[model samples]
Target: MPSADGGTTSLPPIPLALGGDDPCTAASKRTAERASWAQKSLSLPHAWKLSQGEGITVAVVGTGVSVDAPALEGRVTAVGDAGDDCVGHGTFIAGLIAAAQSKGTDFQGVAPAARVLGVRGTDERGTASVGLIAAGIRTAVDRGAQVVSVASALTTGKEELTGAVRYATKRDVLVVAPVAPDGETRPTDAPVDTYWPASAPGVLSVAGVAANGTVLRSADGAGEADLAAPGGAVVGIGPRGAGHFIAAGSSAATAFTAGAAALVRAYNPDLTAAETAKRLISSGPPTGDAARLDPYAAISVVTDGTRSPASAPEESKPLKLPVMSSTLQDRAMVVAGGMAMLVLLVAAAAVVIPRGRARGWRRP
Candidate 1:
């Protein structure tokens, strides 16, 4: 078991794969007792006052989602055997998007009330292919998903994935995906470049960022991203237990953006898919190449499908104070006392001098 904060109770890291031919991810035995940094950074409670993504359905197109995950109970509808998450990655991603608050932990999804639809974009072992992901996109759209979160990012499959995105676009469904695969799945020698589906015209390609607001090094060469969200050291639920597992990558960031999209759709039911995307992008605080995802601003800020001043990155002005050394303070106090004495003398002179002038003629 993996240890965290020098404690044995913390959950182990979720495996992307076993690292061999036909590799599969293993199940985690422990659960994290605390909430993730992403949860605190998002401040979802403020956003929830306006919308909890109550009526929206976000599809998790990945290895699969566990039907019995405690936080996601009664909210997941799986397509075929997609309900069984052997790798646990899909369940983690789904938890980030729509898990409800539970009794034991402070962790909660971005959109707690939104529904989840599970579709397998990767095989049971977490292996992904162009055909499988493309088919999953189409299936999610067919199942009436308002927003689709794709977990896989491939260098190839431009044609098939592009077609799938176009199909979703025409049907007015928003698609969110990572700019590249997570560090675990990406090969060390792979060049940083645009990946398919994310490179497609209508998809919202998201990049991962650490708590410090820097883009994850794993996503450095993945080209420009449409937006950035917290993905590093993220915590979420496993396939079967209430325990939380930690993972990182652009896929986790994509889940956050997808949940924001759901919140936008839920609050502004009349906005088109493109408009909703515009709101998310426009409302975010621009951080270099990609805007940082701000779920509250996405729903609360007023915009005309364009960047608003409320969402612009505020220039950080330094707080300035007067130099007050001990020497200067003492001098200031002396000067103030001198000025007070002068005023008192002037008042005395004004009264005495006038009386003396009047008495000069009387000698009284």
Candidate 2:
């Protein structure tokens, strides 16, 4: 039971505010069925190295979390109540990032093993302003969260939020931005119109998609979706604090993606926030109508490539595109020549087969 914006919350300010959801791993069986297949399948995303994410903490900036939820019972670092659960938004976002499976339920996050730092920025009214958003990001960074997940976005141009993002990126922390929901707008008519931190350079902007693997209404529609996760009327703890509700919007998607990042950083302890983020963005679910989040591949890349003795990539997973390499240009030419030769052969055969052509070459 936390208090209003300036008041004391029902739970204490410590663990309730910034510690990992301390649930027992033994009690919660893993539900990531895609785990084993993720390595072999380029399109399906999966989470691996569960326990490794223990020490890392994720700072979630949104409405706030409920300290006593089953998924987060003993795991809460704070003992007393910090405040009241006004809007249910922050709790759901936190649950997506670090909630455990509770005594009886299947909902969980990409990094169930990591900790959570809840930074409340919204009130009963709506989204908070740049001053609050900047303060939240800066506080989370100072508290040592390697990954900062901002499930909320700005509607207008703001200098302070941009500065906060720049500062966080410079510190080598992975900052996740959830694409704004409908109605949260700026005057520029641009979906990203300098929308403070999310549109600010250096932050990873995440978009939402439906469960049917569509970036729009359904599979038939087309649009830009970076990494899609479960965002439909997803079930989450409610306001009185434990009731359930079906929630939507990009916030849920952003939380899931951020949790995935925590999983990568947890497994590959040697990776800096930038390299970890790169691994996540580069290899996403390859086959869906919309992109899906990839946690395992990110860990593998950072672990094998950046960590250890720092050797060249293996033959099986060779660096195919070496970023503006001369070989890349040469390969492109080779592919083009092959296509051209095939087309020429087909055209020539088409013209010569008018009469007295070989049995195999006769036009149909």
Give the candidate number with the greatest TM-score: 1
Give the per-residue lDDT digits (tens) of candidate 2, residues 1-364.
2111112112211111221333211111222222111112222224543433677788877666556556655443321222333455666677767766554444455666777777756543335667767877887788788888886666654578888887898887888876555222322443343344666666766665554444423211112344565554344443333333444556666777787788877777887776776576655654353346666666664333321111222344566754777988899999999999999999988877764555456446
Model 2 vs. true fold: TM: 0.63
Write candidate 1's Cα lDDT for 1-364 as tens digits.
3232235356667766444564344455655556667887887889999999999999999989989888999999999999988788999999999998877677789999999999999888888889999999999999999999999888889999999999999999999999988984455475648787898988888999887788888787687787899988788878876777888889999999899999999999998887788788878888878888999999999765363211433454567988899999999999999999999999999999889888774555
Superposing all C-alpha atoms, what RMSD in Å does each candidate have to the true structure?
9.8, 13.4
List candidate 1 segments past 4 Å from native.
1-9, 18-29, 184-190, 305-364
The 10 consecutive residues of candidate 1 with the worst lDDT sum are 307-316
Winner by lDDT: 1
Backbone atom clashes (below 3 Å) for every candidate: 1, 27
Give me candidate 1's TM-score against the actual structure.
Answer: 0.80
Instruction: Look at candidate 1 and tell me the lDDT of residue 187.
Output: 59
TM-scores for every predicted model: 0.80, 0.63
